[model samples]
Target: MKKRLRDLGEDALIARLLRGFPGGENLRVGPGDDCAVVDPGRGLLRLLKTDAIVEGVHFLPDTPAAKVGWKAVARVLSDFAAMGGVPEHLLVTVAVDPAKPVAWMDGLYRGIRKCLATHGGVLAGGETSRLPSGAMISVAGEGRVERKHLILRSGGKPGDLVVVTGRLGGSIRGKHLTFTPRLNEAAWLVRNLRPSAMMDLSDGLAKDLPRLAEASGCGFEFGEVPATRGCTRAQALGDGEDYELLFTVSPRRWIAAAGQWPKDFPQLSIIGRLCPPGQGASLAGGWDHFSP
Candidate 1:
């Protein structure tokens, strides 16, 4: 019998299996964070992000193979949505044990095709190999936005209102696997409000917001954080994988445009404000895979 992933340990498994993957070329920043960044140059900034789902790390071994496939694609799409970019294509790579049926691969591909079709994205190309040990799926998404429209974590200014689209937390209940990518909402926002800074809440506001603040060279203050249906204040602030857009906008426009937002996405709400240089991030806690 083969040793389980748990027996090998997460760090050991990553170092052994993933450390040898190729690197360089357009990869501005690679794995080791919430998402990887690939710069396409200075004109139409092409953002590339990839995510993976393993049999044990992301889902139960018995989880539906189709849903597993969908989740894999959704993860990367959500990153593009957060960056306010339109997904144009995807590259999918899969590693499967010899024992898995070919039908399972078919089902996974079907799920990926369904999601790409729904989002108006095309399947590019990818690599496949026999894992001979466990199952793994990786997806690389390519998206683009006008250089001026590309939002980054480093654009907030003092007095700017911090806003969030949709509620947060308790994603594991069901939202994790079924949530829709906020691509439409993000595009609309970029075209209309022109957020000063923006990013998705993947590692929870606690960990992510501070990073944004650091990038923008500012601090933040949250007076009222909007909560999901059954989410507590703590959960709303610290539960990772919310996939909602967190942004900052000038106070004047934020207040003026609040009422004008689309009715379909009424959940958009001002939760805080960018503070002066010394204030720093108030909410400072979230999920860290290797943290004890």
Candidate 2:
């Protein structure tokens, strides 16, 4: 008998199924990074990202269709933000129930267009299809980054200060559907400081922090977590979809950036330090798709 998807789990499934996908010569970074990075033959690099949002799995059927559209594209844009890039073009695939109202689909695309426009991205066209059960969205986007500003998840070193932009947790209350991608803030970070490593917090800090540590072959020590109001510490750590930037920087850079950090930007918190391999690092809480 075939093994169930849950038996494989999200991480295992991604590793097993996508481990061998062929990457072209221009591909600088492939699977495992927030976005695939490619050298476009210029001083600038192109970042490619694809993400899916499923009905019921990611949102309620009753959720506003406009919000649904906003989330579908924003998810991928956040990946660009994680790498300190700016979104330039987008392609969306919408799979919708046949019985859904035409107005609903219109609102969805309208919201998508509005968001792409706000973020200086173009709706470069897409495909649509009918699904038997519920609506699903697939977004494939491209962004550009200056070579000097490009940040990756594997650049972390021991002694780097771990930091997070904005608050975390409680996304299920409604933030997930409408949060803005941290494009400006991430760009600012790269322009001023060389982040040792960076990633977006989609899978919660508990799950994502471990990923950073493992990728960099290191561990970390936790400090005060900047949890969203009304959220318990555990909820802050485990509840996924915060859409914030979690990054590492050298202590010297932190002191310099801290002094000149934009007061108008979202709050920044120094949450910990990366440790050398073999040291204990907290991996206490996070979401697992296969888990109940």
lDDT of 1 at 114: 80
Pairs clashing in candidate 2? Answer: none
The 0-to-1 C-alpha lDDT of every candidate, in the order given, reads 0.79, 0.90
> Considering every candidate listed, which one attains the maximal TM-score?
2
For candidate 2, report its TM-score.
Answer: 0.96
Model 1 poorest 10 in a row by lDDT: 28-37
Itemize residue pairs with steric clashes in candidate 1. Answer: none
TM-score on alpha carbons, each prediction: 0.84, 0.96
Measured with C-alpha atoms, the lDDT of residue 38 in candidate 2 is 96
Give candidate 1 misplaced runs (Cα > 4 Å). 1-43
